[model samples]
Target chain A: MNYISASPALLPARAGVGFKPEHFGAIAADQQPLGFFEVHAENYMGAGGVPHAQLRFLRERYALSLHGVGLSIGSPEPLDRDHLARLRRLCALYQPESFSEHLAWSSHGGVYFNDLLPLPYTEETLAVVAAHVDETQTALGRRILIENPATYVRFSQSDIPETEFLTELTQRTGCGLLLDLNNVFVSARNHGESALGYLASFPLIAVGEIHLAGFFDASEAGAPLLIDSHGAQVADEVISLFEWTIEQAGPLPTLIEWDNDVPDWPLLLAEAMKAQDRLRHAERGYARRLDRRAL
Target chain B: MTSVMSGVAGDFAAALRDPLVTPPAMLSAHAAPAASTRFCVYRNNVAVSLIGALEARFPATRRLVGDEFFRAMARLYIKAQPPRSPLMMRYGDELPGFIARFEPAAEIVYLADIARLEAARTRAYHAADAEPLELSSLAALDPENFARLRLAPHPSLEIVESAFPIVTIWASCTGEAPLTAVEDWRCETALVARPRLEVEVRRAPPGAAAFLEALARGMSFGEAADSAAARAKDFDLALIIASLIGGGLLVPADGVKQMETIHGYLA
Candidate 1:
């Protein structure tokens, strides 16, 4: 059905904040125009409610994106057809500008773990993920963006790097990349890899969205390990990486996430305004480059 | 190959049931027992995530027991009752029943009801949205015929009866009401509803509770009022009716009437 296009026409590069229920009144009454708003798909999976109503209101004023965290794309068990159908229904109802999931699994056997869990980068896991992606696209009737996960530990038996694994998934299934830069910074720090190199390795041509969020330094045994808690301010280093991403891939629809100890709407909107500043600069840079090429 | 994959899937499933012991090392392709470690990670994530979901849905229950105690009980709960849905707000529907039979905290006989209140609050939060009936709609009706008329509760209303002063406990713990010196806390009933998007929980009169319960069971307004009056010296029909309507507990009967008279209309 192609509910979401691979080359979808995104809003002119700008920043948005996650749509939290607490800030709904402020966002509704405020005069600021955000580029869009992103929400955890599971939060709105209810048949109807305040969250649904709030999302319906916000959707009219701004572009909406549905980000899912518990699809368990790497599970060996068959995809939950009911969950897929619910996602399909939500897509039909909301018609979000973009839809995305993680490159990790959360459930196994039959039980669901709400957190995004890491998977081994191997042919078997790859095959499982590709099949799930195919099934999800078919069920959702649209292509999806798969976000790379932040990990605290790495499997000793991993055959492929995270970038290669994500690239392979995109190639085989024609999926797009959400390219969470803060995750790149977090996972890189946790595993002692260069964040810049990791960002450079991303297949940016397929990049559809960018997520910038805070991280917690939960180093175990004095060794630096970052937890993607999304609790605080976006680090300056990650913003630099975001800037580099803008230079490399041009500005995509970026999102600022603050899921824990959520601040007031103005605070979140201010953070989004920070990304909007960067996106505007990137947009002007791209325009100038295009003008120069014409000359 | 299909049979082999299914066997492997079954083995992995069994491993999840008891993941403490060392699993077979060949599950990972690079051969360092990464699958076991990954499985351990998955187990930890599931335990923590589901436990957190429960804690969020059952804060009053958590407060009744301390955080540490709640976490311990929740771990036991995760082992016994895994979530069936990814929509986490719906995860702990069976928890009240589970707490009733749970051995560790069974001494707190009222713990199950407290858990029921918490679960009801969670359900109310996620309940379907509806435009409430205006006060004038009832005002337009003849007072004589009001007793025969049925009032449909809003989609988000839930009533619970507890043997402990659960309303006091919840209010004190959530800081909704100022704390007072402890006395002999009496048994109480609770009414939960979401007139707006947020769910509200508060104590209810026994009469009102009984009335709402009957109405919830599809009783006519006259019968439910009679039931309410049986429980109290003065079940003020005006107060209860106004309260229910004001709290968005009552919906107009148009939809139900339309459904009931469908055959006649078709004829």
Candidate 2:
């Protein structure tokens, strides 16, 4: 079904906040200019009721992006066809502007973990993820954006770097990327790599959206361990990386994701405003670079 | 599947389920110790997230048992009954049964029933939408034919009957009724339905539970009333009918052909 229009112009290249049911009343009552709202597709997979009611109201006002965390797109096993069908039904109902899933897998052997479990990046895993993405896009009848995962451990047998794997997957499947800057920072810190170096190696041209979320920092065995907890404010360092990303990729559809310990509407909106400010700054810089090229 | 990837996924899944297991052997050794700690982070995330889903699904159960006890029990439940699907809203379907068999919670026998009621409420909240039968529509029916009328229950309707006073317990836990005020220790039934946006959980009237349950099973109104009257001594047909209509429990029978009884009356 032609749920959403074929044009890739639904969401504006500005900042939006993640939609939480707690903030539904406030969002409905307020007249804020938001770029779009993103929600976990699994949360609204219910048969019908308050979720659909709230989503219908929001979809009328703002563009929506369905960010799925449980597709198990990178699972070694084949993708769950039933789950994909439900996702397609949801997309048809909402006609969301963009639909995305993580690079991580959450299900295996008929048991779902409810957490985005990591996968080893290899030629074998790459083919698995590419096929899943291809199937998802075909099933939904729309292109999808696959987000990078925040990893805790790297596989010893893996030969490919995450950036290269993601690049190749996009190339093979024609999928876009949802560059979650907080994940980059968290994964890099946990693995003792430079976030900036990772960003530099990232294929910015294929980035269709960006995500900024908070991480919990802990020290384990005297080494920095960053958890992608999404429980706090976006770190200044992660925001800097976001700014760098915007400078390189121009103003993409940025989102402020606060999933756990979600604060009231105002605090979440303020975070989105922070992202909006960065986008504005990046927009000005892009215009200036264009003028410099003209000169 | 590549042996390396399959091996890593299997080991990772095992370690996430049981922390005592060593970190996946496939993890790079460059940050071996840190990777183990990081692996623990994933383990913690899996446990915490699943526990959170359960806590959200069964808030009353959690409140009945303190947070600490609930978390410990939930962790065990999560490990034993991991989700078969990725939908978190549907995660705790087995919790009610699990609680019934849980030894530590055996003292509170009514806990499982309360969890069942909560699950029913969740199901009702997410059930399909349908326009309820308007009371005005019933005015056209002949009074003599009312007994033979067949009415349908809304898709969101659920009646949870329990031997213990689950409605009282649920109400007390949700602050609808004071705990001290719940002195009646009799069996109770809860009527869960979402007539509008909010899911309403109310104590089912004396015979209304049986009446609604029968209607849900496609029984004729006369038969359902008979079932209710058989169950409750003070079954008032008029009062139960009013309650069902006013509560938005009844909908017009759809798809089922109206049948003619032996008396040549349309049912």
Worst 10 residues of 2 chain A by lDDT: A1-10
Model 1 root mean square deviation, Cα atoms? 4.7
- The estimated TM-scores of all candidates read 0.86, 0.94
lDDT of 2 at B184: 78
Clash count, predicted structure 1: 0
Q: For each of the candidates, what fraction of the native contacts does it recover?
A: 0.37, 0.70
Q: For residues A1-295, what per-residue lDDT tens digits would candidate 2 score against the true structure?
A: 1122333334689999899999988898887778999989887877667987898898888889999988999888989988888888888878999999999989988999988888888888988888889999999998888899998778877889999999898788888888999999988887878999999999887788899999987865657777888889999999899988999877989999998899998899999998898899999999999999999
**What range of 10 consecutive residues in model 1 chain A has the weakest lDDT sum?**
A1-10
lDDT of candidate 2 vs native?
0.84
Clashes (backbone N, CA, C under 3 Å), per candidate, total 0, 0
lDDT of each: 0.77, 0.84
The interface RMSD values of the models, given in order, are: 7.9, 8.3
Which digits, one per residue and each the tens of the lDDT, describe model 1 over residues A55-164?
88988888888999878786767888878877887888889988899987666667766778666677777888888998899888778989988875555446788898
